[model samples]
Target chain A: MKTKRIRAGAAAMTGVLLLGACGEGGPGGSGGDFTDGKLVLAVMNDQSGVYKDASGPNSVKAVKMAVADYKKKHGDKAVVDDIEVTSTDHQNKPDIANTKAQELYERGGADVILDVPTSSAALAVANQAKTHKKLFLDVSAATMELTGAQCNKYTFQWAYNTYMLANGTGTTVTGNGDKNWHIIYPDYQFGQDMTKSFTEAISKAGGTVQGTIPTPFPNDNFATFLTKAGSTNPDVIGTMQAGGDLINVVKQFNESGLKERGIDLAVGLMLITDIHSLGVDQFAGTMFTDAWYWNMDDESRAWADRFRDETGTRPTFEHAGNYSAALQYLEAVQEAGTDDADKVVAKLEGKKVNDVFLRNGEIRAKDHSVVHDAYLARVKKPSDVKEDWDYEEIVTTIPAAKAFPPAEASACSM
Target chain B: MNAVLQYAVQGLAAGSFYALAALGLAIIFGVLGVVNFAHGAFYMLGAVTAAVLLDTLDLTLWWSLLVVPVLMFAFGVVVERLLVQWLLRLDPLYNFLLTFGLTLVLVELVKQKYGVSGLPYKPPKLLSGRVDLAGVVLPRYQLFVFLFSVAICVLVWLVMTRTRVGMIVRASTEKPDLARALGINVGRWVTPVFGFGVALAGLAGVLAAPFRAITADMGNNFAIILFAVVVIGGLGSIVGAVVAGFMVGLVEAFGQAYAPTYAQILIFVLMALIILVRPAGLFGRKEATA
Candidate 1:
């Protein structure tokens, strides 16, 4: 009887300890630790699918790195309670991503949604952000419509956009020398926006768009398109294709022996990930525009070095953009002294956000589009590469004023 | 004139890939009486295997071409024994449903494993550059794909007609009960026949890697088109499949060239017109009951 009583007492103690552990591990644990209260910043980015290889995982890592840096800088008195990062596989579907964003906001308490690659999905999430009164920092979606006709007060385009890319690279190249263009674009919103922006910029800069071919998305074979491009025989082939589509087209163009045909490729927008996969050897001497490059300057290089050390891969434009957006948002929140959406947005507007990724960048009051310098880069030859990840040469830095389309050109009423 | 010739050549080159993929679908359906929806998945796997082999084992295109098919053949055998065997006793619809589900599982698994940026595969050095054909500059890789696909189709035809195993399988497909009663052991032949079908898919995939992106979801679109090809061609007819594959390729090529916007629509329209004209397809056997 005595031994049975002792066993029951031990069981009771075990149950108490288990209950205590569960309580402490719950969502509302350690409430008094943060004087300003913890602000949960949920990051929802594409963690799988086509864009996964380019921006998904890296975007998440970048936000985490930025949060870590913020905490280190603020020392012991950092108002940030804890940053909780969660992601979803949008699979380039707007409906799915929008739904996931809503769930993240309502239940997950996501302060900001970052690096939505697909424009359609970005627009959907932006609408949700407006409804929920949350900050939506768009890091990757390139469609000008996000800041144009569909511009929301809640959404801020932090990185590059179609207008900026076209104006910076297409117009600059066409204006300088190569006037006539044979363009091949994907038949989609992003592609349409890119082609329109490029054509308009080229025309405005006294250049001619001789021909344009609109191909379907995820088109595997571009032999026919390349042939058609070659037949046009313009001074330059302006490719607005991105990701795998871009690589396939460029490779096929090279293999078509058209490089010797005097039809140089003027890439409107090329990501470092695409170049890395395709190899710089084949893409040598090609001029393109990018929002960020790892080897841009000392500060950029240092940040890239640290990022590479942590992530084991070079920081992509979208990845760097995520960092920029997160850091800027955190700064805005700090300045506002509250998590209220309007107050934070007010603090963010026209605020000069100085970071390793971007310098002297300010969120535009009219459209919430972050204005920053874009780099015109040429692919470095194999011999020029002193090490891996050193694949680009910054040809010129296009100023913010000349990089993006004029506000008057935008269809946004605000 | 030069521009027209270039477009034609380009069309034929792309048509070759569609033909190759369609031919594989045709062979699997013709021999097994199973609408292998996972044929395109096998094609995708073939390309991915080649890319992975090239990356991991430092294998060249030649080695990958040889090795990938064998691996896929083994995968086919396993699939047949484990999943397809049960459906063989059931209706053809069951096989289709099973294969469709299998495709989803395989594609999702690949996505989970690889995370879909699409691994790049380089063409062999010999077939890397372009060659001028009658004043039309053509990608050498495309030319090779066309030639390779034709060779494979011819080879498959030769095997189906000449070999004893092919004769038995073809005979069984035509008269399953008779072949079974004659002690041909249709059960024994099922696994190898399935393996051969899978091998054809793998071959198409090996040929495709150099031209297309090797993504997990790459097969989904191609599979739907392959189904259309099978319907347009006579079901279970190798000759019909070959002819229809090239025919569809030409149609798609010309359609895209002439009307870029309606190219995809034109394919379905052609399929609809063909179905309306000949319910059994271009070479399909008309049902006596119908």
Candidate 2:
């Protein structure tokens, strides 16, 4: 009798469950998941190649921190459900980054992609995101073509580009009367773009490019390159290289004994992380353009400390940019109330943001290039370095409007 | 004229590294009949080991150079015994694939320990700064590298051609059947020969650390060039490897001077042209290769 009663009860419960299941094909099953009211971000970057340390897997950590901070600050307003971060190492290849970006959008369900370093890879990811109509926030790639020929509605380079760098460092050095330039550039698209940008900037500042040398990327030695630079007897030896290549180039440049001969060095782009690696003594009095510096102010230091605690290393500009881009993206999604591509993009466009990430940051509606002040920084002398991470001393701030190329000059139709 | 001199010096210096690496490749190919594709990885390992020694033990360059090669030599012996020896009787292509895979494993291992951005190795103070070569300026350390590497090469050559060890190695390599028949167990020398070959690669790595970007991937570009040097030198000929190393270097140096962009392509192009002219290479004996 007891068994029969239990069987009857189970049948009744099954009928109720079937009725509840049959009523479930309602508004929630729209298939427009939109990260399920989540801000899903995908980070694609060079994880195991030359650009690994400059911006790699640590970028993923930076994005996650942005998510955490967004939740803590805004509570349920940041994401309707939660923020999710997914990442992959692009290995400094464009095709790989593109495939990964596609996977992130189609399968991983990511709303934004951030922290791609190498120019080629970053450009590829930017284009891919545009085709998919998903947001791409480039953190560390330094190419001008992204904002020029390749600028899209969805792609926004969060960090520095070759043009801005060329403007800040190239113009300043040329303005100092160090004419007759000998430019040594890594023979790649980014390097080529930099060479063109620097030439234009130097001409504007009343300087002549005496000669240009194209060097192999990821060169083993720069002693020969430096010797050739010295051979030309130019007033300035401008190096259009960065990362490990930059480190080798700068080290050999300093040791080439050319400084005593009235030849100055002009680095197109530099980071505090680079200074820390190459030793501040080697770069003392060396002026360069930087997108951001960690110890820029009281607020930045507090944030950097938290970043250091998370990454176990001082936050590079790339790391800081990743955090900023991620946070801004979350805020844009929140403002839009949904992860719809058109709506979220509209919210981000023409938005003037003043957050821990951006000082007077304006996401220009025309081309989606974030315009912000870039710093003119000098490498602190050995005696001036107060701590291990203390490397750069801000000389002056180049306003966003001045630092970035105008729409007419950039010719970005989007 | 000054630029020519600079290119020549630079080319010759680069050639010296190629020759150092090719010497080991030639030895292993001669004794073991395998290409030892891991030679470049071994070279990189030598550099990584030296950098680690300096970072952890605060060891000086000279001492690390001494210690690194021996450690690498022993390491080569163990690898030969445990892994390489198992595939000795197989086809040469199999061994090539094995070593190629080994190179990736070794490179990845190093990358895991030290992040891929590369670590800096400071050159000794004695070798810092540029040396005024009367009218032209050359780096003091580079000049030292040219001289030091040549000396080590000579020492290696002397040991191969002059010493009792050389005699045994020659006999075992020249007539393995006769060597075994004459109460000389040729098997006993295989480990040492493999060890010696990889040791040379390790030594080249030590010599390179101060000059090149000491990273996990540093060996990759050079490894391709090293193979070309070996082929141009005539498969297993030590003297050929030495001669070709300098020749390729000179070609590269002069190429860089004239054609900076196409210099790397110029190397492989030269290799293809040389093969068309001499199938067994410039110094290779036709019958031996056949």
Candidate 3:
């Protein structure tokens, strides 16, 4: 009888767990009514895998900081109350990320979802946001598809896209006498998109593509690819790997002493988070572009100082984007005077948002793309830096018009 | 010729890690007949322990290489005595399930504690740069890992073959009933042997810390691959495990180099082909018919 009781207890516990896992929002979960009349935000990103090093917990912290700042500025009538934030580990898988977003929105009472780091995963969540009629402010996930062919009315792409990074870096480097390009890219959609954009941009700037090599995603051994790249003997070798794969590739490339062989390393999209993982010594002399840098301007520096004080690390591009998106989203809701998704989205569609990171950045109604300055940065030398977290030196700032892809090219019906 | 030599060196460097991990898996299976799903977790623990020690005590890689495995060995002993000992009398499948569950628990605990953001571990200053090896430059750290792994494997072989303790271990696996009849406390040795196998895994983790990103789920992929290595090597054969580990590493490295897209698929294909030819593994002994 005692054994039977124990078996029954185990079965009951399993039932409870399964129900909890499968249930829609219980009280106080995401997408529930904000009883306290405060906007709750859900910051979802790959808390693990390739994007984690740069975009995970720090991004959540950035959004929180933005909420705190917004609350301070609009103290009386614009009080942001009961603001809660939660995160999920997407592990770079689209299916897992999509499920997590659904859970966040359906059960967590999130008014706005921010900082999804993968492109495919971002697209999944964007689709879900439209179905749910919720606001999705994409802080990362650079595929133009989120604001282009796969664009949804409820979604906004706030940070750098593949087109911006590709055009900014590729055109500049190839035009400046580094005309012959060799490419080593990950064999995925993101990699293919980057390579395609880069090649077109380079050729458009009167450069030639010597060769291209696509490696498997999450590939560890890069010696073979590096050796093959060395043989091609291009003016510059454009790397399209991200996260730990990027670190491994750069480290191995350095180890092979290939830099001495006259092949320059050019990164397609190197974030502040990647630089932090790699350190200054590993990335010195490497050039890349980003939407925001912690030390770029007084506003960014001041905001980063506040963020670092709270989070104990420098804010990454995804983190900065989260702050930008959250601030804009809350402002739109305030302007719309209601939390109705369509009303708030309409308010945000053609509005110009000024935040600590972006100056006079406008939300394009054409595809919900945020138009802002894109920074062309080079990794600062060890001797050039005076303190920790001081890495990039901003080379040039591309204007909003030149930085964004043309609406015709974007192919975003929304 | 230079490119081939370069790829070969790269393959050997990577193979060293696979070989060390496979050796641990083989040892556990040979003596205890447990698949040891937590071996990779133990490996991750080894790296994490080293990182924590570096933070707390400012320990260098030299000291971590010494201290981390010892601590993990004690942890292994505790786990075996408390958890694994209960499942010994049951079917091997029960042990597999128990250990697999333990792996999930350990990984989750680590993720909770470390927060899933990969912690970076820099190589010691001495091992930071590359060395010119026959005109091909190789990282000094990779070279060290290769040599260190081989030395440990040799040391393990020596202890297993040249000592009386080794004889007893072999006898226990071969005929546990007879070994117990001969007045050997076979039950007592099980825990320590398991602990030792776990320590070997921990050592592999310590060696891998600088080379790879130290994350909570680092062990999951590696552990699965380690099983494939053991299977290809002929499960429960130490020498076979080491050989097959290097073989898989080489195949994977070269396959990724030449084919690019089909690199991971090639590994599974190789394992399938090997199993077709040798169902019991390359070094596995045929079972005696009743």
Candidate 4:
């Protein structure tokens, strides 16, 4: 009888401990009311499509890395030990992104969605985030609309945008005395925004906008457009094409003898993957702007080393941006002591961030634009590259204040 | 005047790709009574094969132009025997469905092996720079592609007209029922004819390797435009395919040059206008079913 009473007492103690573990949402123990006692990070982007090489699967891996680093840094103080990362392919379609974003928020129980690449798809997802009242950190998509006309309380425009790209490349190139410019861009939202931003920057820097050409997105041939751009004899031809289209334009430009005709080429935006696809020699001595380079500094190279070890290729700016965004999101969750969207939004807004991807970064409260220092780099000559994937040589740094448009100029009423 | 001449040359040069791929599509459709929707996939495979050959085997563009077609021909024969032959007697839609499925499989397989960023192929140093044709300078590579594709089309035309085997194949393609009634045995030539047609597509791909982006989806737009070419030329009409291929290329080039916003739309407009005029296509023989 005495032993049976002792056993019942032990069972009561064990039950109480289990109850405490389940109900712990205060201070230290699994802090905050987490859904299912865990955090779910959803990464949506183009996985098997044209933009795959730029971000795709690598972005997912970067998030996992961020989770690991966060756990390591926070150790036992980590808000939630069971952080889960899930991913789906949006295929760069806005409708698909809308459907998938709804499913992820409603059914999949994702707390936050990250790394949406295409601007149209990203906008669709931003709408879903607002409707669902879920946190979203956009890493790859570059349209300024996210922070301009389309800004919301739940969405944060994380990486570089069309405004930042144009502000850096346009001002730098025009300031270098290539006063007359002709721009060719894809006839889409992102391209239209880029053209507008570039024209503004060019005229501001005393450069004349000679012509503007709008071509189809994902077009393989640029010979016709290049010919038209060259006929007017602009001092520099600014190409606002990206991914496979950009490669075609560059290749055709060389083949068409445009460089020989004394017309300089200025890329509106470029990534390391592009340089890697078409060797450094194709873009030798060409000046362009980049948000982040893997080999930028020792801190970045250290992170990049870990990234390359996980993924076969070096991380692009999108990949690094994802890592930074994820880590920062988790940090905000921890700071707010909960994964609640409103609380996390308060935590992230106006927060200064310095990381491998974002140099002197600051998340603006009014517009939610993550302003950061952008690099103006020249594609190193083939002979200058000492190791693999060493493509860019940083020439100048566009400071964070000058990299993006002022918050007061934003069209976003939010 | 120089700009106009340049645009003309550019249009013709762009047309060469459509002309070559459409010619194969026309021949295959002519002989097999199959739409062969995978013609675009075959073109993609051709360019990919050339790029891979150069990347892996250290082969040059010259060798690729010579070798890729032969390889594609062999691949075409195997596909015809293993998958396509089984559906030959069924409704033509079945064959179309089968080839469409084949295109998906081949595209995914390629994407699995080589990621979507695309591969690089530099033209031979001999053909890399520009060629001055009087005052209208053209890229030597573009000029070479135009000339090379024309030579190939002529050779194909000769084979279709001059030889006894060519005559038999032509008879089977143009009037299969009549040829079969005459005891020509149209079944025997189907395999080689299909192989020959795929080879032409592969040839076009090889020529395009140095000129266009060598990606898995490179053939997607090319294929769509090729359908417009075949339709504009009249389905299964060899001369029509070639003529319309160059015609569409010129239209697209000029459209892109002058009406930048309506470049793609212009191709369809031209297709619509031609269809309105010639319901049977410029070179196609109107069939009872059609």
For model 1, fnat equals: 0.52
Summarize candidate 3's per-residue lDDT along B176-230 as a digit string, tens digits: 9999999898877788889998998999888877666676777877887889899
Give candidate 1's error at residue A167 in angstroms: 1.6
In DockQ terms, which candidate is top? 4
Given candidate 4, what's the lDDT at residue B258? 95
Candidate 4, A262-309: lDDT as tens digits:
899999889898888777888898898899999989999999999999
Residue A107: error of model 4 in Å?
A: 1.6
Question: Could you tell me every candidate's TM-score relative to the true structure?
Answer: 0.91, 0.92, 0.88, 0.95
Per-prediction backbone clash count: 0, 0, 8, 0
- Candidate 1 colliding pairs: none
lDDT of 1 by residue, A292-401 (tens): 89888898889888888878889888888998888878777777766667788899887776677665676888888888888889999889998887999998988777
Q: lDDT (CA) for every model shown?
A: 0.78, 0.80, 0.80, 0.88
Chain B only, TM-score of each candidate? 0.95, 0.96, 0.96, 0.97
User: Candidate 2 chain A: worst 10 consecutive residues by lDDT?
Assistant: A21-30
Model 4 TM-score on a 0 to 1 scale: 0.95
Every candidate's CA RMSD = 6.6, 6.2, 6.3, 5.9
Select the stronger candidate by DockQ from 1 and 4: 4
Compared with the true structure, what per-residue lDDT tens digits does model 1 show for residues B1-290? 77777777776776667767777677777767798989989998998898889889989888987898899889999999999999887888999999989998988898877666677676788987678776877777778888988788788888889998779988887788999888888778888878878977887888877767677877877777777777888776777777777777776666667676566667788889988999888888886115
- Candidate 4's error at A209, in angstroms? 1.2
Please tell me which model should have the higher lDDT, number 1 or number 4: 4
**Candidate 2: residue B271 Cα off by (Å):** 1.4
